[model samples]
Target: MLKVKFNCFFWLFLLIVSCEKETVLKEPVIFTLSSDSGFIGSQLIITGSNFGSDKNKISVSFDQIEGKVDSVAVNKLFIRIPEKLTVGAKLISVSLVDKRSNPAIFNILKSYQVSTVAGSGLFGTKDGNGLQASFSQPEELTMDKKGNLFIADNFVIRKIDINGNVSLYAGSSTYGHGDGATGIAKFNQRISGISMDDADNLYVADYRFIRKVDLNGNVTTLCGAMNASIFSALLGITLVDNSLFVVDIGQIKSVDLSGTIKVFTGDGSFSSVDGPTESAKVIPFKITTDNQKNLIFTEFSLGSKIRRSTTSNVSTLISKESLKLNGGLTIDREGNIYTVNGDTIIKIDNQGQIELVAGSVAGYQDGFGNEAKFFKPTGLFVDGSNNIYVCDTFNNRIRKIAPIN
Candidate 1:
């Protein structure tokens, strides 16, 4: 009886050890990612160890947003980047059972997927949400740090929140010049350009005047004079460092914070000549600045061209024959230039190579890349995430072009 009992105890101990070994799982470990950066929907290969060959048991995420796991192996994982992820650096990780792999950093690049963020496609001033909102020939637009977009809609300035709600931000729609509260202030009928500073103070180019709107909704005339010959017709406006640059008829003018106006570039003649800053003549329509503070403007004369003005000299960056560039000019963080050519959006790289970003023929259809359409797209604003907001002027809508996943 004692021998039999000993045999039974030994078998029981062996069975328990076998069961424990079978149930134990090794924690997944990540060695490296095939690539550190890519656009949405792009595939990424994760290589590591202890990632078992069971695809159903593996999970992946980017910055806590779940990503699709295409395939999985013991030492490799194929993942599809998820959609609607905020552009920039994202932390990627893998999971198996209850254990997560080491986190890795990945960068999401800006891709194109066009969608209308506001406006009803009708010409009016009614404000609401999405299609419920209406705009009257919207032109220039700029966004604040909080993601609230301010638009130059006809004679009034409109605001659209990140949730797609639209309302009047400034200007009373009276089509004249006046300085007072936002609701009581009046802007000219031709409210050409708008820009915002780091403090959320808005600077607008209304006809021949440069107006400033404070955070308290108070409006004031920053610079420009109706009878002043220095400004023929104020078009585009951009803020760089301590100066605000404005496109005045055919010249580029700079206005200091105290409202001191000076000719920054161009000879104020309707011609295209690249030379010294004061001697260069460009029929500029819109103006913006790059990361290096280089003033970039679109020359509407002598064939459509994009020019750059340094501290003391001006040079032509891109020249296309009979392109008829619009007043839309924006630069990405990478210094790439985005402008409008008739009904299409054109992107110019640092090498001066031009590429079509979106739109083909004029219409009002939202799609991806060339499939998207814009009717006389005007002002463009690129946010921190590299997402672009376009003033689809004739469409009377504010459209967004974001990375597609």
Candidate 2:
């Protein structure tokens, strides 16, 4: 009986050692992961032993959420952290068949949130009912660092607080340019574009004038008088670095803090010709600048264009085609261009691929991407947090597209 028991134990030991060898040889090993904590949709790089060359055989997951594998190599795997995941520690595991490697711990974070905070209508109305209030022909939208949203609604500048409270920040009911105290002052003319400087002061393009409004609602004409020759009409405005890029009647002009303005682009002509600054198409509608100080603006004449100014001040047409990209322009941190192309909001990625961000079928629905609809959506503002606030014009409301969380 003792001999038989010893034989059985020997066989068992051999089996255990063989199983260990198989595990060591066949199981994929994990050495390093890019980050232990990241927001949903963050790109994570995992590296180390034996991820395998055949990506089809491998699988990765965060907690119960399956990660979208961007790419896979023999020893490295690129994964986009799954979206809509709860914020907390999640077990990250990579596996091939039954050879599941030791799990790693990753923490998921909250990302940008997209929602409609105001307005509800098939065509929009100026309800003025606060949180559920609506807008009337909202043109330009800008945001301060403190989360306050400002809209150039018709001739008035309205403010939507962080808590979604709406109130008239500047301008009076009556239209026409009038610079004075807060409520008494009037934006009697049309406001084509509006932007905020580093100090949170607003630069408004009111027909023939560029007005400045302080925190206390003090309106001051920054540049361009009622008959200033510097601009025929100021359409789009953007504050970049320390300068303001304004789209005049036929050219893009750069104005210094002291109000000294010069034609930054446009060959002093408003034709559709693309050439050097002095010969480039001058009639620009909306203007925005990138981190590199490159001016981006849109034109709707001849071959409609989304033009960019090169470092050497040369004009470069960027939009895939000549489309009427009417309305506000903003660029993301990744250099993606977000603009209002009529009723739809389109995004031009760094690779120049145009994709729809919102507003497809048109008319108000206020749902997720593609599912959500807009009526003549125009004016876009991207905050420091990458939240996209859109002026749903015909809907008379501001819609926000919070990035993937």
- Please name the candidate that would achieve the greatest lDDT relative to the true structure: 1
Cand. 2 TM to true fold = 0.70
Off by over 4 Å in 2: 1-114, 120-131
lDDT value, candidate 2, whole model: 0.77
State the displacement of the C-alpha of residue 264, model 2, in Å, after optimal TM-score superposition: 2.1
Task: Please give, for residues 1-405, the per-residue lDDT of candidate 2 as tens digits.
Answer: 999999999999999999988865367777878888776655889886767777777788887678887888778998877776886898888887678787888877544444677765433334454446767778788888899988888888888888888778888778777788767788845588998988999998888777899998889887786776667878889888888888887778888878898877675465866666655666788888887878888877655678787545555456445465877789988888888887777778877777666666767765555556777877898877677998878777788987664
Q: Output the lDDT of residue 404, model 1.
A: 62
Worst 10 residues of 2 by lDDT: 122-131
How high is the CA lDDT of each candidate model?
A: 0.86, 0.77
